[model samples]
Target: MALLKEASNLKLITFAAIQERTENFSYGELDASNKPPPIQVKHLNNDRITGSAAQKFCLFRLFPIIFSDMVEHLKSFKIYLILREMLDIILALPQRKSWLPYLETLSINFQCMMLELLPDKATPKVHYATEYTKIIEENGPPLRYWCMRYEGAHLYFKKIAMQSYNFKNIPKTLAQRQQLRQCFLMSKCRFLKSYQEASGNKIIYMHEIDSKVKVLLNHRYGSQFIQSQTLLQCSQLIHNHVIYKQHAVYVYDLEHVEEIPVFFQIIHILKLNQEWIFVVDLLNTDGFSTKLWSYRVSSYDRLDIVSPNNIKYYHKGLDLYKVDHFHVVNLTSRLTKTN
Candidate 1:
């Protein structure tokens, strides 16, 4: 049965489809991406999924195809919508004061839904979740004060101290070790790996490129680029530490924090004068398909060129799928705007 055309909003799913839920969604470890890292199937399969993994799974993986199970259980689906909106506003740091009121309403609705559907399962954590809006309004974005990064660093030093048995003057030992490591990194020039790297087996030259792309290049760069014998081209781009592959989704426009954002898929990755350019096809921004729990986007024929520097969010790159006649994109993360 097809959706967005047929009467079926909730479709039956296979067991394999359920098993591959987390497997189907994956993202890189770029900072500000706030995406869950690559997880092993065994560790995250079935009962093994709990704690932070469950939260990550709920916020990232589970929502994409949630509509399949929502029709029969409308109350449960209402909870999902509330949580989805909660995530969109909360997890997206730099929480706006204006959105806090709407967040309060979402939280209240979520509480009522939980009480109505599964009151026995509602725990203290749910209570804490309701306070997020108030906390943000009083203390600013919670992510700004998150110690996870610092905790990771501390763990590294803890391992070193434990292995070396350097308890005496631990601070001094840590300082010396860090200094040596810093010197080693500087000497090896590993710190400069932040530069973009073009990946893919095929190498494309200017003449070998599409006529439309050539026109775009000439129109934008003129002879400065047209005179060049060849241009650097690739099917994959690694910039700002995030991996962007051809046809992958990235936010082109975050119109409003409360509204559904617009996305564009990278049609081409080209480089000229040491700057990377992305030729992209904009996704239709009518709104997300609530039944699919994914953004239903009709691909555009007209191509637009954008720069990596001009990207609003550098951290997350989403995946786009061809679902029947239209395309759908599963956003594995929130739209947290950044320079």
Candidate 2:
């Protein structure tokens, strides 16, 4: 019965057999035409599959086939794998819980393979500028294959059609098309946000380390230790500890809860000393609320923060092979200064 129904559907569509003399669709033929081809709107009156289900089916089947075809066609071609931040990509996925895990797993696998093929050094540097320039630099191929953030997709497509094929102008009017294009760009943003939120939550467990740091400092150095000490003895103790000695140290003063001053101090300290500092918020929950106020300290100047939220960002940036030292200090107690 299923096979019969499928055959009946195939029979309904009109099929045309092409002779050997038929002209294949080519860029030259498309360009030589005086006017743009008519955009056909297929009006389906029947209540067939829902748009969402059809989209899922098409994505699952047709998308894979398209990628396979692309790979086959480009076997001799140099492909550029343009990637956004992982958090951004994750946030951009559809919000349905049922599909998220699978999407995440697939994205991770794809990213790993892409990175291996084109190592970081081989890929062009990412910058916010003309999308075409970035794409051209990243790949050896013509500019047509470069992909970018959805915000630049329309401009990219427009440029490709005009420059690559010498098309005068696309028939579609900007006013008539802007709404649909914007909708796609916005949808991409939403998808990215969803994945970023999920990824951010996954790293929330680091808050445990913050809590432990607070407790350890309070117990050993006394409650008023941070206020009295010019330099945190606990930090030296951390340096002495096997696990934390190599990690760059940053101390946050809970007393000054404002954003600019704190950030200025952090930036100044880093710039003057040329050392990356691992930031620690001195205040409890209240200080964590502001996005701009928190500090990030690291050993390397080029260290990138993985988390979108500022509070959870901390240093795990140490060479594990080096010998480490640990010590404990009381911030309230006066001690002789030593180099």
Candidate 3:
């Protein structure tokens, strides 16, 4: 876990994702997708490659839940840097098509470094490293994707079978029922109207500000944050989200006992008496939720947003190493103009 938060590790992960082998190679005339080809690699390297970084990372730490929690503890400058590198490396491995040669080079270096750092331990080789390269050159899809789908289907079948008492012809019956159901579903009209559409709520009339910026109403949680009288005509209307400009609103940590400013991006906004109520996505900078480590999370069911007077202006720059398990954009160092 400690190594997971290291700055070096995160940086390595970054290099694996973006950096080319010589840092001078050009990938001209990319396809319509504008992305490189996919890469394939095996999960194991056999008994000889024991206790290797590649093995541990690819096999053990690849799980999203575990990796996300590990990313939260990276706070100190030294640790943050190491963690950034580690994340980059981990992310790069599965993206074999983008940087196969570079990944191979880095994996070799990682294996060597791990062996030297822990001299007494026998380092496991990257299982099927050469084989992975050959498979990728021959244009193979990632084995992990197919394996996961198969495993999921197997589990589903097992669970469904366990629930039924009739084991005599379960397999045959299940297959027939599934096929019939699938065919029935497939025969349905592709343009079938949903309940919402049939109910005439298909198009929601959104209030737009200045003909360009569409106004969003406050959710139940966001409405409770501000005083009732401070709100204007749209106070009672509840919405899922709102978008607002940074100048019109500021993010405050209502959940924290000490109540301080939290950096967040305002994705939506609502108009009040005179101020703007914001719908914000929390920034993953100071605190992150980890099961292993208790941290302050928003009391609101969704992310909490505030409209405070204290709008601290700071330079924003891109921090590519920042990871958001919730899939929200973290605050960048790049500066944006505000009133």
Listed in order, each prediction's TM-score against the native is 0.69, 0.17, 0.35
Q: Write the residue-wise lDDT of candidate 2 on 64-182 in tens digits.
A: 12222122233111222122222222332112233334534444544454455434423332222123223333442222343334435556566645555544445554433666767
Per-residue C-alpha lDDT of model 1 across residues 83-189, encoded as one tens digit per residue: 77786677665455777898898898888877877676587877878898888988887767756568657777878788888777888988889899889878966
Question: What are the lDDT figures for the candidates, one per model?
Answer: 0.65, 0.27, 0.36
Between 1 and 2, whose TM-score is larger?
1
**Ten consecutive residues with minimal summed lDDT in candidate 3?**
195-204
Q: Pick the candidate with the highest TM-score.
A: 1
Cα displacement (angstroms), candidate 2, residue 316, comes to 24
Runs of candidate 1 with Cα error greater than 4 angstroms are 1-17, 20-55, 66-74, 147-202, 206-208, 222-229, 235-245, 256-260, 332-339
TM-score (C-alpha) between model 2 and the true structure: 0.17
Model 3 over residues 1-339: C-alpha lDDT tens digits? 223224235553332322232122222121111222211111111212233233233323222222443344444323233323333433322233544565456555544554454334332443333244445556544433335467555665676678766689998967876788678966864435321111111221333222222222334435542334232223121121221233222233333443323556454444445554555556543453232221232323234445533334332211112234332122211122232
Summing lDDT over every window of 10 consecutive residues in candidate 1, give the lowest-scoring window: 1-10
Error of 3 at 243 (Å): 20
Ranked by lDDT, the better of candidates 2 and 3 is: 3
